[model samples]
Structures are given as structure tokens and as C-alpha cells.
Target: MAAPPGCFVGWQPLLLLAVLVVLQGQQLRADFGLPTAVMGGNLVVRDANGINGVLNAMDRAFRRFNPTGQTDRLMQASAVISQIALNVTELGRSVAGSVIKAASDRSTPVDELFAKLQEKYGRMSRYLDSEVQNAIETLNKSIGSAQSLSLKNALNSVAAAVRQITNSTADVGSVIARIHETTSGNTIFKAVDKASIPADLTTSLSRALSNTKDQLTGLSRTIEGMLKNIGTTNAFLARFDQTRQATEKNIVGNQQGVKAFIDGEKDTTVKRYTNTRNAIIADISNAVGKLNVFGTNQTLLALYDKHSEEYTKIYYYLFNRNESDIQNISSAFDAIGHNMEKIVVDSTRSVNSEICYNKYSGQVINTFPGYQNGVVNCMTREKNRLGRITDVMDRMLQLILSTSQDLANNVASCTVWNGFDKSETVYRQAEACLHTNINEMAKFGSIIGRELDLVQTLGDVEVAASRYRLYDCVAARNNEALATIYVLNKDIDGCVSEPGLQRDVLGGGEKGGDEDTEDPYEAGASTTEEPVYDEYLMEVFSNSSSFGDDVDKIM
Candidate 1:
């Protein structure tokens, strides 16, 4: 057969034909050793009979077995094989690029995580508002209750005083005239008539009324002074309001500042961090995108180097090149692959190192909203205490006003030293004077009784203390003198002992052995002992005797 157009013939074609035949069989099992199995699978070797099957089909087309015809047939087979290798290389690049692009995509998870963080921040703001409202409500309730109780107490005190005064004034005439003369007047009103009594008796009665009036005036002045000093409790409330307002402003400002800081952190720091991480992921995706090109170039370089020389000698192989060209091609492909791989590996490391999940672990800043509540609680407690104090001052003012007004009314009606021409009015004034004297004297007697009881208790305490080994002798002597003085002051002539000993001593001392008719004085005195009166004791007795004589003279 004659050589066809644009064809060449030589021993190189024969050897090339034999080499292609051998290579086709091995190419069916060739492993390109790609970095990714996905790209490798797209290569022709993945098929069991990709190269060999095609060659066999081409071989079957050559029925005329002659040298010239065989050379033409071998050349046609190489062209077909080259075309198939190029197509498979393109397919592998496309498939590998798609896989890497899919693997490197991370925008979805990033968006979802950012949205979740934003929701948490929103919930934090809501929680602060709810907490503040609850605290304020509780504070208001506490202050309100305190104010109510204070007002109630003041009103109840005023009501009690008014009721007492009303009962006392119900029957003035009977109240003034009613008197039980069961015992002698011991202190003030010994007799009703000034002519029948000592001058001192009248003087004492006048002094009593003057003193009562003076006490009322003094109390009124004191209340007026307090009312003037405090003026109104509004100042306290104003100051408290100022303090509360300042506290609230500070608390609100702090809460807002903390919230703003968190919001700023999310916007600036957290956003920047997320953006940086996402950028790294994008870079890795770009590197992965380049991996397909590098893989395709490597495959093409190997194929061109292996078959270019043979294709050039056999027939019209347009891609014929030198050994250095093939080596440069391989080197370029290797460099690109190395760089892309490095970018992929390094960018992947960066993505892996990113703190995407739970970025704000324990990052919440405590604004101490409870500190504001504590301030409120303390302020409210102080306000409540101040309110109570104001209530007490108001009650005192009420008492002084009411009592002074009543006294003024009484004094106006019961005028002092009106002429005899006043008739019944003069008599009524005299009666009021006598009644006041009697009331004052009765009060004095009760006071003296209480004083005596107190002294008795003191003496008993001292006497019981004498039983102790450490009791001072001087104190015991003083206590014994006090006891004797108390007995004598009570008009008991004999020394007394403990009540139990008194019962034992007086058991058979009753008249005709009748216990019911026992004398109270003898029963009270456990033993009737004659006291050895010292000088101080005698002086006390003489003063007491003088006191009694003065009382008798006044009567």
C-alpha cells in the first residue's frame, strides 16, 4: 500500500506501533496516583478494558495482513487512542473540580450559627428587662406597706387618747365631788377649806395646778419646736426621691452600657472573627478549585511524554515535542499541584482552628442588676424608718395640741380668785380647785406607795445578797437601815422579816387563837425587835417625824 497524505514511514513507526500495543494493555491497569480517588476514578484506567477494548476493535478493522496496510492500521489506532485519552482527561478534571467545590462550601453552617448567636443576645436583653421590673414591683410593695402601717399606728394612738379624755369628762360634777375618805390624805389635799387647813396646803394646791399648766405649756413648746424644726417630712421624701432617681439612673445606665458593650462585641469582634474564618474557608475552596487543573495537567503531561515521539514518527501527530519540553511540562504540573495542595492543606488547617461552635462560652458579663435592687431595698428601708419617726413626731404633736387645748379650756372655765359676786360660778371654781387638789393628793399617795414597794424590793434584794460570803458589810448595814426606815415610813413600829417567817411567828399570836382576826401589822412582822438606832438612823427618824408633824399641821 502507498503512504497516505501527511503521513511518514520509518523503523521508528514499527517500534512505536509495537510500543503502543504494549502500552495499551498496561494503560488499562494504569494508576495515575492522583491525590484524590474521585479524580482517579474519572481516568480511563478505572474501566476494566478501556484502552485494550478500543485497540481490539481497531485491530479487527484490518483484515488484509500486509506490512504497508499494517503500518496504516497501527497509525489509525494510535490516533483513536490519543483522542480517547484526551476526552477522559477532560472528564476527570471536570469531575474532580466539582467534588472539591462541593466539599469546600461552608456558608450554610456559618449563617445558621451566626443567627443562633443573635437570638441568644436578644434573649439576654429581654431577661434584664423582666428582672428589673420584678425588683421594682417588690420594692414599691414594701414601701407602700410600711407607709400604711405608720399611718394606722398614729391614728390608733390619737383615737385612744381621745377616748380616755371623753370618758374623763362625761360627768365632771360627780367626778369632782366623789371622794373616799377611808384614809388620811398623806401628800397634798389634807382638807377642802383653806380656812380649816394650813396656808401651805392652799399653796401646795395652787402650785400643783401651776405645775400642771407649766408641764402642758412646756410640752406644747417642745412639740412646736419639733414641728418647726422638721417642718414637713417632704424634705426627707425629696432627698429620698433624689437618691432613688440617681440610683435608678446609674443602674439603668450600667445595664444599658453592658448591653451595648455586648452588642458592640457581636458587631465588631465576633463579626470580624466569623468573617475571617469564612474568608479562610473561601481560600481553601479556591485552592481546591485549582486542584482539578493541576490533576488534569499532570495527566496530560504524562500522556504527551509517553506517546508524543512515537505519534510524531508514525503519522501526523501535531503535538510532537522534545524531551526537555516534556520534563518542563511535568515540572510545571508538579509545581502547580504542590502549591495548590499547600494552599488547600494550610487553608484547611486555618478553618479547622476556627472557634465556630460555642464561641461565647461563659462570656456573659454580669451587670449585677441585684446591686440596684440592694440599693433600692436599703433606701426603702431607710425611708420606712424615717416614715415611722415622722409618725411618732406627728403623734407627739397631736398629743401636745390636744392636751394643751383641753387644759386651756379647763383653765378658762376655772378662773382663779373671781369675786364673790360671781355666785354659782365662783362656787363651781372652788369645787374644781378642791377636786384638783384631791386628785393630785390621790396621785401622790399612789406614787408614794409605788416608791415604798420599790424600796422594799431594793431592801429585800440587799438583805438576800447579805447571805453571800462576798457581800460588803457596809452595804448590808445600809440595807438594814433602809429596811427599818421603810417599816417606820409605813407606820409599822417593829422590825419585819420575810413573809414566810412572818406567817410562822404570827401563827399563835392572834386574839383568842382566831387566825381570821390576826392583826396585819403583827402578821407582816416576823419578829417584833427593838431596833438599835444609830445617829444617821435617828436623824432619818427625826426628819420623818418632822415630816409627819408638817403634814398634820397642814391638815
Candidate 2:
């Protein structure tokens, strides 16, 4: 008559109910204790008086009726069932009255047992529901605390970066304002005042100005030292011009015949003329070399080293006082661009050579516009300088050959006529034009040498000014980047503000219109333009072609 371990002989309902209650209690224990298994969210309530406990007490009462299977024993089972029914009412009130009424209607052991287990399952579900609620509350609190700490740390990082950027901006503004103050009537200075400048900016400005002044003074000293060399070169060329004219008249005027004069002048007048020509060439070469801009351009230097013995050879340059010589020298002058390439390289290095924005690659990209613009200004100034030099050189070449036309026509008959009278006429015209050409060349070369020195000095100034402007430009860029970061930390869509970042960096530069901006070298057009020679020297030669066939062969 006894029930099985998990089932009963005729007590199926009670046995099934007890087993299900135990199984459900274990599941509730797992659910309620899940927080402890992971991060320990501190859920306090456990399965102490849950439905499993109530069922255990009911099982004991059922066993008491096991020995006496009589009608009176049904009262004992009912009493035990009523106790469970009360527990269900308190825990799950909705099913309390229904469970009790269903048990009373059947009054049989199996029917009452089924109603009891149903009520116990409901009680256990309610207990788990309460515990699960507590666990969720604890989990929410933990998540909130963690999120707050993360947000705070993020804000702190952005705050620190913002503070650094703000200080840098102040230092940069102060430096620019100080520059403006000293540059009274200067383009940028006119727009800013001391009242608008921050106190910290003044200190940085003072240091920058002091350093700039020192650099400028050093340049001034360098120029002052070069002035003596320039004077020496000018004096040498002046004396060489007078000596060349005297030598030409004495030697070429006394030739006897065409063949004897050519043979005789080769060792005397031609040798002296070759020496004077080479000397002027050396002077111009040395003047350009002293600049140290381009170390040594061999191709340009080769034009000056023609031998006196090979004076009439077409292969040589200065020996041919013909159109070919003009072309050769022009090619050499064109090669001056190779020398000026150094100015471009040096100016680019000066503006953006150092790695200032190491933190971000994008910031490095931001510096390129400034570097490019600076180089453009430098090359423009240098290009104009080259134009002026060539302009004066062009005028010199035109002046030197201005009187060659009449001589060419007069000598046209000499080539046909063959005598001392014909030879002397050709020789005199050739000698006169050659002497005048050499004198004028020496004078013009001296002027170009002086102009080259001025151009080099102005090029140095352009590089320095570009470097200063680039410093300001990059500082503005870095500051703007930091400010954008600060805004991004606080806002989700911070990228919207980044489009104008580079624009803001170049804002200060836009203030300097083409005129003010183009002249960062501080040398205006009128300042760098080549000056005219004295009227008497400029008008010394007639606008006639005098480089006749005899003049070409004599050279």
C-alpha cells in the first residue's frame, strides 16, 4: 500500500506535486543565485519558506495517514492540505480561494493532492518573481555607477587637452600681437593693438621680437662685411676697362698686312684682351660663388675659361665676338636658374622642415598649404630678381653691339679687295668695336655683381619671414584641432565642425591681400628693381652694328 519514491501506489497526485515543487525550487534557486555566480549583485532572499518547504511539511502529514487508510484519516490529510492552502493564499492571493474550493469539492485524497500541488507551484513562481525583481534593481545600480565613472574620465581627458590648447592659443596670439605692435604702419600691425592682446602674449612676443632682431642684426653685419668686397670688385673692373681701351688702340692700329696683323696681334693685343676678358669673367663668377647659395655650378663656370691661343676658333665662346658668342653666354645665364633652385629648396625647408604636429597625421597635412604658399612667395620674389638681372644684362648686350652695322657694311668690300689698305680698314673698325664692347661689358658686370648681392640678401629675408608666418599658421591649426576634440568629447556629431578647421587656420593669412601678402620679403618692386647706369655710359655706343666679319675674325 506504500507509494513509490517519486510516485504513489494510489497517491499519484500528491507524489507528482511534491516532485514538481522540488524541481521548480531548484530552478528558482538557480535563477535567484545567477548574480552571485557572475558579478555578485547581492540578491538577499533565498528559498527558505518557499513552496518546497511547505510541501515537505505536507508530505509528513500524508505519511501519518499511511498506516491507517480509513475515513477518519482523510480529516488529517485535509488538515495538512488546509495549512498549505493558507500559505498559498498569503503568497499568491489570486489562486488561494480557487485552490481551497476545488480541494473541498473533491474531498478525495487524489483530488485534494492535485489542488495542493497546483497552489504550491504558484507560491514558488511568486517567490522567484520577487527575487528576480531585486536582482534587476541591483544590476541597474551597478551599470549606472560604471557608466558615470566612464563618462567622468572621458570628460577629464577632453578637459585637460582643451586647457593645453587654450594656453597655446593665448601664447600664439600674444606673439602675433607683439609683432603687430612693433610693426606700426605695417600691414598686420595696423589691424591689432596692445589693448586687444592678452598679458601672456606680451612675454612670448618680446622673446620672438628679440630673437628676430638678433637674426636681422646678424644679417645686417653679414651685408656690411660684403660691401667691402663689392667695392673692391667695382674698382678693379673700372681700371681694367681703361687699360683694355688703351691696349686695343696701340696694338691693333699699328698692324701692317692682313696676315701679319692677325699673326702679330695673336701674341700681343689678343693675349692682353683675353686676359682682361677672363678677369671680368672671374670677377662675376667669384661674386656669385661668394653667395654660397649654389655651391659651384661647373657648367656655368666653364663659359669663362677660353684660351688666348684659340681666339678665332668657332668652338670657343668669348673668342667669337659674333652671334654665336651671344647665344653661348645666354645659355650660361639661363643656367643661373640651377643656382636659384637652392633658394627654393632652402625656403621650403625653412617653413616646414621640423615635425611640429607629431600627434596626428591629419595635422601634418594641414601644414602643407602654408608651406606651399610660403615657397610660392619665395620663388616669385626670386623669379622677379632673376628677371631684373637678365633685363639689365640684355640692355648691356644691346648697348655693346649698338655700333656694329656700319662697320659690317664697310668691311663687306674689304673681303673682296686684297691689300694692306683693305686690311687696315677692316682691322681698325674691328679693333674699335671690340675695345668698346669689352669696356662696356666690364662696367655692366660690376653692376650685376652688386645687384646679385642685394638679391641674395632679399632672398634670405623672404625665407625668414615665411618661417615666421608658418609658425603662426601651424599654431592656429593645432589649437583648432584641440578645440574640435573638446567639442567632440561632449557631442556625438562633432565631426560636423571639422570642415572649417583648415579654413580657420588660414584666416589670418587672408587678411593680407595680394599686395601685403606677396611682399612678405618686405622688398617692394621698386626696391628690388635694377637701377639704370649713368646717362653718359648708357649712351656711349651708337645703335649700329659694328661686329663686322673682320671684328669676328679678330676676336
Candidate 3:
């Protein structure tokens, strides 16, 4: 095509095509290898085909080959080929602009790949079933016996297209590879980064990569097979792509296993560290808890030892002799209380506890919600009972002292060493005093015995020990009464032997009537079953009296 003289190109939409056409003219002219363009400038209009005239030759060849390859088949193929050519042309224009833009911006140039239904891939891909294939099928159906010549031509066209897919994919791969190299580090970035495709490109990019892989894999599998590679499949695998699918599945499985192993190792390490930390903490806590208990119990053990020692000393004091020292007894009691106060009651002051019980049974009962209070109350009652035992012992001690003073006074008055007359008077008086005091002591002894029983049973140490002293006192008084009765008989018998006294009066009394009334009372006999002197003491008194009488007869 030739441009008009002084042509003014006003079509803005077709400006790129017009420029390409002008370049095509200049190319055609210079291809003669001449030094200059003949009668020309750089400007001229051209057809859609460049100087190679590939579309033009296809037209002319189909027409010339029509005798062998029929005209109708050629015409049908021509339409589909023409559509494919148009799609390629448009895709090329768009890609060229994008590439130029990429060269300027350092961005991805293969913009067409992201498009699902673009001209180059989507429309051109349809040609496998469109004109060239349709023409071959039509001619094949028409054939009665021999293969049609037109079918061969149609097949050649289809073969050419299939070859072009292979050749063109290399060019597309190079462009995509460059884009991949540029975007590898940062998958998602500005305008032409990996985001331009979706899992990170690993989002959009993975899809793009998967699409390329599937296309290449499908192409490789497809070209390796004949018609059998087209459509048949099972649920397990696409029959045409079974080998490639298996390869991809194995690769994916390996990647997942590697990821899972790394993750498992990380989790195991974390769990191990956590368990170690917990175990160490537990050990530390256990050791510290034991140490704390050991430290806290030192005072408790000391108090127990001290209490035991004091308890021993107190028992020794109360029961060791016929008389117990109240000071020693009080001191031991107070010391034990002090130890309890420090060890038991001191800490119990702050401690609160929940105490529960079934309360329906009928009995003497005291209840509180807190166990600390209950412990305090029990300790107090124990102390009170101990105090009550001491009080009982105190009363018994006072009674002993009173009775002991009377016995000592009466024994002092009766001068046993004097000659019988004066001694007899004092002795008789002492005997009457002894009898009265003995009887009085016996009454208190019964009382003390009962009190001692209670003290021994109820009291822990103090009152239980006092039982010995009280019993000793009672025995001592009984012995004193027997001694007094024996001395009185000796005094009265010796006085009868002296010159001043008569024997009859000495044996009984000064008056016979008085002797009948008073002397009827026997020595060492009492109204109650418990005698002031036991049988042995009474026998000692009677025998000594008979000895005095025998001594006077011998004189």
C-alpha cells in the first residue's frame, strides 16, 4: 500500500498501526540493500500484514492448492485462520505497549499472562476445534475410501498451529521468568509485582505459577500423545495428564512433609522447655516448703522438751515427801503454761479454721465455727481443771497443818521423863487430847482420801502427786496417837507405885461411880469402823501397860 501525497494522519486510535505501517514501507525499500529509498520519504501506509506477507501467502497458496485441496475446505479454514490472525495481531499490539511500559518502569512486561481470556492465549486456543479442525473433519466425513487431499492441507494447518503453541510458549516463558526473577524477593509490591497475579502470587503468584505449570505440563503431555490424550479420565486421575499429575502430587507431598517435620520439631522443643521449667519450679517449691517446716518446728520441739522436764520435777515434788512445796508446784505449772502459750496458743490466735459436725445427738455439747477458738477453750478448761486439783490439795494441806499443830501441842505437854505423879496428870490430859485429835484427824483423812482419788484420776501431775503426802500425814497422826496412849498407861501405872496415889484410882479414876461412867470407853476404840489407831497400835499400848504393872509387882 502507498500513502497519499502530504497525508495528514488524524486517526488517534490507529496511530500505532499507522506508524508500524510506515516503518514496514521503509523496511521493504531498504531490504533491496540499496543505499537509499527511491523517490521517497520515511512515510507510507501499509496493509495489516508486514513485508513477510504471511497471511497473503496463505491465501494464495490455498487458492493454488485448491485442485488437490478443494476450495470449500480452504474457504472454511480461511475463516478460522483469519480470526486467529486477528487475535494475534491485537495481542501483539497490547503486549508491545506493555513491554515498553515495563522497560520504562522496571515492572513485569508479561501482563497478558494474568488475563484468563486474553487474545493471544484464549481466542487462539479455540482454533484446535475451530476452522482448521472443522475443515479436516468435514473432508474426512466426505471421503468414501481414500484420504482426502484437502484433509491433508487442513491437518497441516492444525499441525502448524500446534507447533506455534510450542514455539510461542518459549517466548512467554522467558517473559514470565524475567518477571519471576524480578518479583522473587518481594512477592507483593507496587504495580507490576507478584500481587498482580493472587496465596501471596505465593497468593496470586502461586496461581500464576500453577497455571503456567499446568499449561506447560498439559502441553508436554498433550504433544507426547496423539488423539488419545484429549478427554478420557477417572476419579483418580485425568487420563491424559496422569503421569504429570502424579509427579506434582509427589512433589507437593514432599514439601508438606518437610514443613510438618520442621513444625513438629519446633513444637517438641517448646514442650520440652515448658516441662523442664515446670519441674524445676516444683522441685524448688518442694524443697523450700520442707525447709520452712523444719525452721518453724524448732520452737515447738523445744517447748515439748521443756514441758516434759517440768512435768517430771513437778511430780517428784508433789509425791516425793509427806509435804509438797506449793511454790515448786506452782512454778512447774506456770512454766508448762508459758511453753504452751508460746508454742501452741500464740500461733493459734491468728489461725481460723472451719469446724463441722453432726449435732443432732443428745449430749452436752459446745460448738463453734472456728477450730482455733475450740482449741483455746479446751486449753483453758484443762488449766481450770488443773487449778481445781491444786485447790483441793491446798484444802487438804491446811487441814493437815491444823491437826498436826494440835498433836504436837498435846505431845509437848505430856512430860514422859518425869516421875509418875506429875507426868500422870499431864499424860492423862495428853491422852484425852490425843483421842479427840485422832478422831478429828480420822474424819479429815476420809475426806482427803476421796479428794486424793479425784486428784490422782483427774489431775495430770500436781494433784496426782499430792496423794502420797496426804496418806503419809494420815499414817503419821495415827502412829502419834498410839504412842500417846502407851505413855499414858506407863505414867498412871508408875504414879500408883509412888507414895502419893492409890492403885484403884490409878487403874480407873478417883471416884468409883465416875470410873463406871468414864472408864467403860475402851482404849483405841471409836464409834466409827475406822479406828484412830489400828489393831497393831492398840496392842502396843495394852502390852506396855501390862509391862508397867509387872515392873511394880517385881519391885
Deviation from truth (RMSD, Å), model 2: 38.8
| Per-residue error (Å), model 1, residue 482 | 55
Q: Per-residue lDDT tens digits of candidate 2, residues 1-555?
A: 666586545667878887886665444322211122221111101211122233344334333422132122222322322333333224432322332232223223333343453454344344433433433233223212222232223223323322332343245434433443465333332223323434444343233323322332332222222222223323332343344344333222221222232233223322333343455445433432332221132321232122111122211334344244334333333323322232332222222211111122234234344434443443344334443433443344333223222222332222232222345664454344334433443444344334333433443344334333433433333344335433422332211222222222222223333232232323344432111111111110010110000000000
Q: Tell me the lDDT of model 3 at 359.
A: 21
Mind giving the per-residue lDDT tens digits that candidate 3 earns over 418-471?
A: 222345554455345434433443343354345434433333354333322322
- In order, the Cα lDDT scores of the candidates are 0.29, 0.31, 0.31
TM-score result, candidate 2: 0.19
Q: Cα miss at 510, model 1 (Å)? A: 75
True-structure lDDT of candidate 2: 0.31
Best by TM-score: 3
Stronger candidate by TM-score (2 vs 3): 3
Q: What is the TM-score of each candidate against the true structure?
A: 0.20, 0.19, 0.21
Which 10-residue window of candidate 2 scores lowest in summed lDDT?
546-555
For candidate 3, what is the TM-score? 0.21
